[model samples]
Target: MSCQPQYKGQVYIWLKNKQTCLLCGETTDTPQPICTPCESELPWLGDQCGRCALPLPMADLLCGQCATRPPAYERVLAPWAYDFPIDSLITRFKHQAKWPLGRLLGQLLALSLQHHFDEGLERPDALVPVPLTTRRLRQRGFNQASLLARWLGTVLQIPCAENLLRRVQDTPAQQVLDARARRQNLRQAFAMMADAPVRNRHLALVDDVLTTGATAQALARLLLDAGAARVDVYCLARTPKPGEPA
Candidate 1:
């Protein structure tokens, strides 16, 4: 008699053997849903600013913006550039409620961060997700940043604090605003939890993507003012400057 196993479901098969890629649908050897080839081609951020993770000609060099007017966060760690498949995946996961994509992306981000930790990256005392306003939270049904931070915390063994920061203002969408406008829109937007113990603690702000970084700057400044010794920005992807290729 033939001894080939017959699986009851795709989940069982995936658990037993090969895992399917989330993007190209091809089978991948790695535990991640993305295959190695797809991952290699996924617009990984290269030669970025050490402080802001902005793509530049050299790695670890401060970008013009940071050199002139530095942001509140000490550093930024991003694994991918906001382009192509990564952008599409983030949009689907955030706007369309496609949670599977979020999970996959979170896994990938955790792996990258783990590598950073292995290479001597300083781990934060806590992971703080950029909070959404009550109105936006109600509309979206979930906070993508919080969800991603939860997954990352689970993998990295760091504490995730969803309530560390609260959104006090229901600001307009930032996508339509310029840098100055974005900064203005976020003024007094975030407040620290009165009971949270953040004084002199190193905290990392977690988010889905980094665009102009106006949001991060605002939140980091708030954390600093609240007595955080250091604030680092952590995001899955970083978008290029305006007029630059993604």
Candidate 2:
């Protein structure tokens, strides 16, 4: 019986990992979709800010913003620059409730973070999703960040603290705001869950995309204030500075 279960488990994983490319509809028998050619053409991030993962002209450099005013989190890690198909995928996954697309992105993110951990990246004690407001939650019927965090936690063997934080205020959607406005809009927008036991534990915040980073700074500051040893941010893609070519 034990051997039969093991065999079935292997078959399940094999079938789950093999799928056609989600983008091009090409047949693929690999662990993740998008296929080799489609993935190679994806806007992988190049040189970036050591802190925010914002694409920069050079490596080993911090963007002027991070230099002038350091963010509360330790750093941001992302594999792709938000552009073209990535943005489209995130839009469909988040706004259209496309679970398969979300799964693909989450798996790719898990692989990237796993590679970093193998190379000595400090593993976090828990993964937290940037919580959605109650109203937004009702409208969306799902939290993309929470889903991504759970997927990453499962693949990385890390625990996910999906309820560690909650949105206290339903501030306007930040997609329309400038960086300065985003900061102001998110002030006191989030609060830690009561008795979350965050003291001295490292945590990483997971999200679909990281843009102005106002949301991350606010959440990281909350965790740090609650005595977290460290905080990091993870996202599938990081946006280039506004008006800059990707």
Candidate 3:
């Protein structure tokens, strides 16, 4: 049996046996909000840097930047490149408080990470989201990274520790600054919780995007300094270098 509902004069069919595609509003058998076509159309990351997940002409090679000055985190696992609908989706989810979009994206990311785990990627001991300063948390009403970490943790059966890392300073936003400036701005901005037990444990830092990786580098350094054995980044999208083709 199927039930059809009309909203704003548009008819949407709800099938008892199928789900709806969030992107195109079409009925699909896939359990996730996205249908197969929309899922395939997403900008999946490919042939990228082994360390930073930057898009590259070839696969499994460290980029020049990483080879010269390595980041604190061991590696990144970003499944998509920042492009097209993804950018729009993230903006809506982050800035517009569109919780449903964030939930959908988180679900998709969890599935992708699971595949990586099955294919030999080591699962981390804990998932720690990049924290927002109290000011930003108050302004935004919610931390997007923390929400993502919580959703991912629930799906993967990993512990989501919100207090593992703390943003001690309300640093300026990184989007307006160059890479060097961003790094300087974030220096000493993060600190680990005094009671958090991170020694010898592998941790994955969760974030919505990895642009220039300045924030992740800062947090990863903090985690390592606090005795974490390994720090890996698990972001939804990786932005290409400025002027580089996506």
Candidate 4:
């Protein structure tokens, strides 16, 4: 179990009190909720395929690929696209060590959840974040997805389970790889822990971003194989196929 630090202070209280972009570290005298320029720059998901969450032509509700090969996870809910300031925000948060920025992203994710509920979506029984490799955890000092999951749980009134899945293998980063490569890289990388307290639960697997649905599919496969009844993905952002027509 991860040790909880003495309740020092609320994270949002700290960020909202300061006048800098929690994501990009840019200073703003009055950041518009989350830096106006930053929020505007965030890639919004519009007309995305319901199955995989990839952007689709307005005429077509389902992308051709998803229609051909549906993913294991039932559905994906992505509020934003992975581009521009959102890209910069995620890059900084994950790579440059901007940990506090996750709270800002979490707020957006919470709002998205409310919107989802309003649209008659069923809430998950538990929030389970995509597991990080132990190697990465030691290097980064935190898991952004886990932090987001905690916030998501608080907002949705669902419990967050941090250790339902374990990253058994330290796979290569997905960004530098192609679709097939990404799938292969994550194969057997994750496993449902036998000792995990989650079983037969409707789970929402949270991640910072969703690109090809590869990671989520892989993790979902493990969960189902281990007896999870259903797994849905909840991501902060989804990346459109590079250079694809909007």
Candidate 5:
């Protein structure tokens, strides 16, 4: 039950108060950096698979893949599809170390999550970020998932278990792999720490995006096997099926 904190500073406070739209360079009056029009025009996820959050043609329907074989996680909640501007924004934040962009996305995600919470979606007892391998951590200097989980935990008032999970193997990046290959790549990749919090409590996994969902499936399976009562996923966006329209 450890707390993950938010950044505090005059600059952070200023950003939290009011800001300009990052997408169009327009001055916005709201606390969120993105203005209303840009926010509305973002590639929002409309109908999606209830289990995996795969963009779907209709609401309240499971995608064929989920119907055939449901994932280990209970469900996924994402505000947008990983398309054009969202994809680009995430890329910049992840690769370029753009802290403000990351915080903007995190704040928007927190609002989406709060709406769900108000509508009676069960909140988890803790948030656990999908971990990065030591090699990758050294290479990147940060784990984006850990940062997202910390921001979400701070905004949502939940404890974040940052070290509860560990990546034991430095597997190939999932982005370049297809679904089946991604599953194979993640085999025996993650481990739980000695003081891991995984028993009988509802937990949520936070990450940047849900691509093939292989990483989420593996982590959720691990948590469930370790006696977690329930597990859910919260991510900024969900990538649609390959060759599908945005």
Candidate 6:
């Protein structure tokens, strides 16, 4: 899959040298970005509820959350659990500017989609990245979610509409608050382009990670309000809540 290259100069060289795995600095060129040993360690999400993507027993497709209050997004498909080396790797990608890992994460997400075709995620009409506010984009130099969406669009043979969604207002980081606070903080945080060419479209909302599902839910609501027929989320990892099953 083609992606906008992020690393440059000596940092790029170090990334190439450390080809074993982005998570653990091992060695060797495995077909997958990660080495075989590291690959086994990736906490792949499996047997999840179809609606919430929460791990569930084989007979059930809806988790308690979905049963009580469904999400605006029809379904969520994530590759791995937010834990261990994967968590640390995402942290580096987001904070330390270890950007080459974006390509690796994109590849893993594609792999997950391909593996779980039964989840019913086909090639959507378009891929929409959970947008970044202008202020945050300027500070970060890039939106990590957009990076993943671009690569995912390439892999899925779908076009990515980066401009369709806009962060009209900057909100506090979701990581800093509880789920209820996160939802309250993000209320009206996103605004669709007035003339968005997204009506009746089936979209896959792409993000680097899914924490409490608040942001994805808010984005999905906006997309549906803007005439998107359906919205499915494709995230790199799903932060399993405490006491949730493995």
lDDT of 2 by residue, 64-167 (tens): 99999999999999999999999999999999999999999999899899999999999999999999988999999999999999999999999999878999
Candidate 4, 1-246: lDDT as tens digits: 769877777566665566676646687555334666666667778888878888877734888778998787888998887876677778788878776666778877788789989999988988999989888999988888888899888877899998688899998899898889999999889887778765687888999999888999898888887788889999888888876742
lDDT tens string, model 6, 1-246?
A: 769787665554444454566556677467555778778878877777778677665645787888899999998988887887788888888877888887888887877776666565466888889888899999988889888888877876679998798998888888889889999999989888878887898988998888789999999998898888999999888876666644
- Pairwise lDDT winner, candidates 1 and 4: 1
Model 1: pairs clashing at backbone N, Cα or C within 3 Å? none
lDDT for each residue of candidate 1 in 202-225, tens digit (9 for 90 to 100): 999999999999999999998898
The local distance difference test score of model 2 is 0.93
Off by over 4 Å in 4: 1-32, 35-41
Q: Residue-wise lDDT of candidate 3 within 82-150, one digit each (tens)? A: 998999999999999999999999999999999989999999999999999999999999999999999
Judge candidate 1 against the unseen true structure and give its global Cα lDDT, from 0 to 1: 0.92
Candidate 3 residue 245 Cα shift, in angstroms, is 2.1
Q: How far is candidate 1 from the true structure (C-alpha RMSD, Å)?
A: 4.7
Candidate 6 local Cα displacement, residue 48, angstroms: 2.2
Clashes of each: 0, 0, 0, 1, 0, 0
Q: Candidate 3, residue 196: CA error in Å?
A: 1.4
Sort all candidates by TM-score, best to worst: 2, 1, 5, 3, 6, 4
**TM-score of every model?**
0.93, 0.93, 0.92, 0.84, 0.92, 0.86
As a whole number from 0 to 100, the lDDT of residue 33 in candidate 1 is 82
| Candidate 2 weakest ten by summed lDDT | 4-13
Q: Please give the TM-score that candidate 3 achieves against the real structure.
A: 0.92
Please identify model 1 stretches exceeding 4 Å from their true place.
1-17
Please report how far candidate 4 places residue 81 from its true position, in Å. 0.9
Clash pairs, candidate 5, are none
